[model samples]
Target: MNLLYKSSDESATSYICDETGYYLIRLQSKVSEQNYKAAYSAVLESAKTKPYQKIILSVIDDDENPLSVPFSARSWFASYFSPQFYKLAQNQVDVGIVKPKTKLQTNMMHVILGVVEKTNIKINAAYFDKEEEAKEWMKCPT
Candidate 1:
């Protein structure tokens, strides 16, 4: 994995995995809503450099605490950012998400995934307990 971008506060980081050919976004426990947005934006910007077909989002933290965004914010992002992402990838993108540890965080992810799934733009997404699983899934032919 090659580091593509990292937030100023070190709350988030983006990488391009050579093995899976997927853009990976990792969020730390300290990540905020603003930093989360910036992280995705950074990924989209990096996508311009080299088009990618898949993305893996790792909100899982090594410790107990994990990244969690409010339902409203997640909905807003799905409505606002998904379109830009779809366009940036030329109308297609698959996403593999490593689920958070806590129930609350996991529920929030389901909501965001629901919002994204409801959108007109087709953004294929799946959830996994581990980043390795997501990577394996992402590498398969779509």
Candidate 2:
């Protein structure tokens, strides 16, 4: 995994794995609007950097410094980011999300993925408890 972007506060880090053709965005705890956009900019850049269409989104809980996603950030993602991203990928991207530890985080994933589905993008997305499993799943044809 090569580092593509890291948040200023180190709360988020995005990686690109050329081997798996998967872009990984690992977010720790809370997601502020600024941090979300910074990380998403990297995602857009990654799509432009290569035709890679797989994404492994991992949201991990940090017992030491727990944070939550703000409503504004979520709204921004649903309203602005998802549409642009899907359009850029031509609705061909497959996203594999590593399931988070807490119920709240898990619910966040549902909401985000749900919003993505509501966008009417023909993308495949699923949740897994293990990252490797998600990667394997991504390797299969949808």
Candidate 3:
């Protein structure tokens, strides 16, 4: 995995593209609007050459393992409404693993997962705990 890009702002974020063309996005803190734009920009730039429409998103809280943290409602809505997100989510599959340590976190993840699934756009997406399993789910069979 090579460091494709890093957007260190309120949160230290790093995006890595693995050998199988799967993106692994790691975040250390809460996400900001700027962070979302930068992230999407990075992926869009990469997508120009290699269609890495698959992503493994891992967000960590405190000393815990990598997990998914809820973006603000603004970001959530943006994901569904933005043209950039449309480009990313359309015909794309992203694997999300949010190591939820709290009930609220788990609920939030489920809610976001549901929201993503219920979107009008067609995208193959799901949440998982194991990175390997997520990668396996994202790949097309040879």
lDDT of 2 by residue, 1-142 (tens): 7898888777878888888777888888666778877887788777775757778887777456555777888788788877777777766878888888777777777887788787786677787888788878867737
Which stretch of 10 consecutive residues in model 1 shows the poorest summed lDDT?
A: 62-71
Judging by TM-score against the true structure, name the best candidate.
2
Q: RMSD, model 2, all Cα superposed? A: 2.1
C-alpha lDDT values of all predictions: 0.77, 0.77, 0.57
Q: Worst lDDT window (10 residues) for model 2? A: 60-69
Candidate 3, residues 1-142, lDDT tens digits: the string is: 6666666653535465556777666555556666655664666666656666566665555435333334663354446433354575456555556454556566665676666666654555566665566667656522
Candidate 1 C-alpha lDDT tens digits along 1-142: 8887787877788888867667988876766677777778777887787678789988866446666554555665698777777787888889898888777777777777777777777777888888889888987836
Output the better candidate (1/3) by lDDT: 1
**Model 1 per-residue lDDT at 132:** 88
C-alpha TM-score for every candidate: 0.83, 0.85, 0.64
- Summing lDDT over every window of 10 consecutive residues in candidate 3, give the lowest-scoring window: 61-70
Native-vs-model 2 lDDT?
Answer: 0.77
Cand. 1 TM to true fold: 0.83
Sort every candidate by lDDT, greatest first: 1, 2, 3
In order, how many clashes per candidate? 0, 2, 3
